[model samples]
Target: MKSLDLSLRQKRILHIMQHNDTYITSAALAAKLNVSSRTIRNDVVKINEELAPYNARILSLKSRGYGFESEDPKLIESLNQIETAFFSKENRARYLAFKLCFAEEPQNLYDLEDEMYISHTTLDHALRDIASQFSDHTPYIRLIRQKETVRFEDDEMKKRLVLVEMLRKSWNYHARRNAYYDDNFIEPKVLDFIIDLVSSNLNKYNILLEDPSIVFLNLMIAVMYYRIRDGHILPYEPPIPKADTSVYYACQDILNTLTDHLHCYIHPEELDRLYLFITANRLLDQTTLTRETAKDYFGPNTRLIAEHFLTMIQNYFRLDFSDDDDFYITLLQYIRTLQRRSDIYNEQYTSDFVKNDLRIELIIAHLFQPLALQYLGKTLTETQLIYLAYCLCGTLENFVHNHPGDKLNTVICCQMNMPFLFAMKRRLESDFGNYLNITALLPVNIKNSFDFTDTDLILTTVQKPITRNPATDTLYMSINMTEDDLARLEHLILQRTIRKIYTASPSPHDLFINAFRHEKTGHGDPYSIFRDMAADFINAGFVTSDFLNDIIRHEENSTYAICPGVAYIYSLIPAEKSAMSILTLDHRITWNTHKIRVFIMTCFTLEDMPITFRLANLFYDEAYDLPKIKMEENPDVLTRYYLSFIDEPLTP
Candidate 1:
């Protein structure tokens, strides 16, 4: 059976009907589609041909609305396939590029130019063109003096963004190819020059480009260099120039020798960049010279590069690295890049300061060596070192009365994993000495400790627990355990909590009351103290029409308070603004809302809805439910009891 092409709207209509089997009213479909009933009818006719293969039917119901039914498995499969293909093109491109860049070789333009007839001027032009390509991303990438790199800059945010894009594009390019050399595209030398130019500039900028995409870009650069060195492969049609023997021979010799040296694949584009860099630096002659001589000039310079990175991390974040990689070489590379380009440097410092800092980082790592050994499982990475130091420093300040105390009382409840908790504990004591007692709880135990009321502070792993005690006034903290871990955790937490839940009704009554609970024990809303502030208004005769109007005006400009569920509706004339309250009914009111709920509402004037929305987000962080927690079986009573807490007497 031939499949018909369907528009997105058509597909949406089909999808809606497929799930809503039985007679569905035309009005209901119209509502879902945000169109008129007549429009829905028109859509039905348009989709009829596409649905014909499945013998599908769109029927109207007296009650429910409009729905569809079909028996054709083939049709469903075809629709699914169409959907997949329609959405996957962009993803595939991104994924391919990421893979290719990482798989390529790492080399300079001089080596690549040795394999080709390209003049220095041509190579320079190609490099410049590639750099120009990224000009649009200038908000994130910029050209700064080579001698004046800083660790911090006013535009740090933009720089990070550009670095991310560069790495992403490079990775995408590499993930798509294995060999760079083929007669179907530009010479590998050209491409390599472009890749290297971008990469070197990126490095020079001292941008911390730690992203998975970097690996891909690196790989793409490598493979492309190898290909171009091996042979000329142009992808464009015609206008292909035949290579001169002398030029081809030079390129071939350089390519062959380098390939053997590099061991992995090298793309032609990388070769181009190598040639440009070597030629620009007078390193091009080294290729023709003895192998050992080339080694001296082109060796990995791993330590020097590594030191450069260590210096950056220490200055920007005020953290030191112990030179640990632990399966994080790619991450390390990115950090080094960020350090080099970050505008944190001041003219006051000498070269010795940079070297001394590297030495200090090395020394710190050695100090952490014994402490890290305490953890039986898990390898350490450089990123973890900083976190460990912070934990130890905070602990010492809190627990230690004097310098160099003995036997730290660190209880790691560790809602976090053992490795993170252990590393943190180690770094703290090693750096600060035993001046403190630290207890870290994994989230599971942290929740239990809430029951005890004994823990001074709960070091939780999860962000924004569903319940927190307000009376105790516990301090909340946000800390980064590792570079990637912090970003991932923050993203996951915010994504779940910040996005509003669209509902058809108010939260169940039980949920409303439970939402106010500081813990299992009940209390008036902690924010109820604002009522005293309100009392001052009443006693001063300020709680009048004029006062209410003032609040309304204030709300017009900015938020009055943070109210989540129970909105306080106030207006000059309640009747005039009563309709404003209707906006609150997302769905018909449901009676079952419980403790794991969002609660608070403050409505002063009809116009304050916008203000309400702005403040609604303040508590938004607290509403995310723990997936592990189950609802109680006595849900109805729980709901009623929860609501009673709010409706029940607090003062009388």
Candidate 2:
């Protein structure tokens, strides 16, 4: 079949229909293509001719727009070969970025709209997405807009951004090639030639640079040429970077060589600024260069402040790595980079501390937060804290906690074959490290012959009545352990009571008297059920009338069911008003239109978020069944059941 040339819009419509078998409405296609339904109809006819060569036709429905169906396999394969503007969301982002970056003049709305073949609405959205996307990923250069006029015009930042991107691409072995690089007819041999010249000069000066470093210097030089050649020269007076004389000299030598190659009038301060960058980058390839070699040139104040932070961390964590020279050297380097980053970001130090947060980032932030204001003179971002924490973990991981290893004796009573049992055991050891010892693996044939009384824990495929000590609990697991199972097991290894069904606590029969009705509401209306529950709590003196406000607040947020058949809702209350409530629907009732078999509510302060979080996890366990626990008969049963799973936050 011969090829057919289709417009970008038509190809997109065809691509959408080709991938999806269901009929797509013309109105739907029109909205996506940013055109009227009539235009979509007109495009469909031309698309049909394009497909006719491949013996495929688009199925048009009366109310529905169109679908694609083809008997020939070669038809779809040949369609992929057709080069059209079938750009993905990411491709559009790159295209917009390229247009904005290289544009000498501010681009208007209509111009961008025509260039992209997009509706004004689509172009505006693309611009906004590009700005937001780059703010997170590419902080050096950003997309700017003023009253619908747009361009990317941070020049020095532009050079930095291009260099950063090139370095990133070199490291990202599996990263997708940029679509614009293929579409835009831009010259790169000039880029390559300038890079080669810079690389050659650095080698000639006996400066050992990494491949990415050479690429960066090469790209930066090209950026200077392209901008200057087009009459976009940076001011001769550039801010000098804080650096030693050696780095300043090396930076100048490289720039001098670049100027000679291009026959360009290079500014002197530009050389110093570039030198400052190399010094900040810290990509010195000399193997013999020790941390002290760099530290000897650092300011006295930076060293003193870093030493204070090291002392505080050491005292808090009960760590002693003061003897390690690498630790001191790396700490000094972080201090320097942090200052530069803080200056660039304009992050000011504050006395505020972080609350207990779950993510590793928040934890690290909370730990070093106090030191930031006193020493660094600025608040540290989570990103900065993250880098510090990772470095600390890496350096002190091996020798810090080498006192003695305590291994728990664990037994795996799997009915599977020996090969399968060993594989499962190895996987456990790999995940848990030296925390557990697989002392025994009993097969199904010898189940009765084995004694598990001395074991700490027994894991099996199914629940079995094994004679063991009361302390030695049995955990039933699936043949294939998932990530959730591993997490539960890890917690179980420490707590050993994570899956305890019922710990046998006081039953709450009096909290709800004859008012506890088994009535099921229509569609499980939340307002109706909550009204009745609030009455029961008020009448019983468990809570005051203001409890209704808390209930409404919880319901309005549309609390999601933590487990498959469980929904938990809670709000902060006065210490006196703080109480726990349980309501198990007689029949499955809908809360927020989602079926709820079990409802647990707790009115407590912020200190209890961990308790609520743990309760949700407990209910989500697979072995759990909602109907089995009769809340009316035993209200306090749920209370007793959860006592074993309460874990205080490590910090608190």
lDDT of each: 0.36, 0.54
Instruction: Give, for candidate 1, the lowest lDDT window spanning 10 residues.
Output: 574-583
lDDT of 2: 0.54
Error of 2 at 543 (Å): 22
Off by over 4 Å in 2: 1-93, 130-148, 151-188, 191-218, 238-253, 260-265, 283-335, 342-362, 365-433, 437-652
Q: Give the Å shift of residue 102 in candidate 1.
A: 21
The numbered model that scores best in lDDT is 2
Model 2 lDDT tens row, 573-618: 3223334556666566544333565555554322322333334344
Report the Cα lDDT for residue 31, model 2.
Answer: 49
Task: For candidate 1, give the lDDT.
Answer: 0.36
Instruction: Please report, as a residue range, the 10-residue window in candidate 2 with the lowest summed lDDT.
Output: 346-355
Candidate 1: tens digits of C-alpha lDDT, residues 1-652: 3444555455556655654436667765654554567988887887776667667766655656676666873355345223112222332222222222232333244543443345555544543443443333234233331232212122322333333343333122222221111112234454455455545544543322323333433433444544445552323333323233333333344555546755645445434533332222221232243423434433354334445545544432233333333212433332333333321111111122221223222223323322233421222333334322322332222322333222232233445567777776675455433333454445454454445233323334444542344211122334455544433433332222212211212233322343322212222332332343233334444244444453444333222222223323222221112111111121222211212222232322322222222123222222222231223223233334334433331111
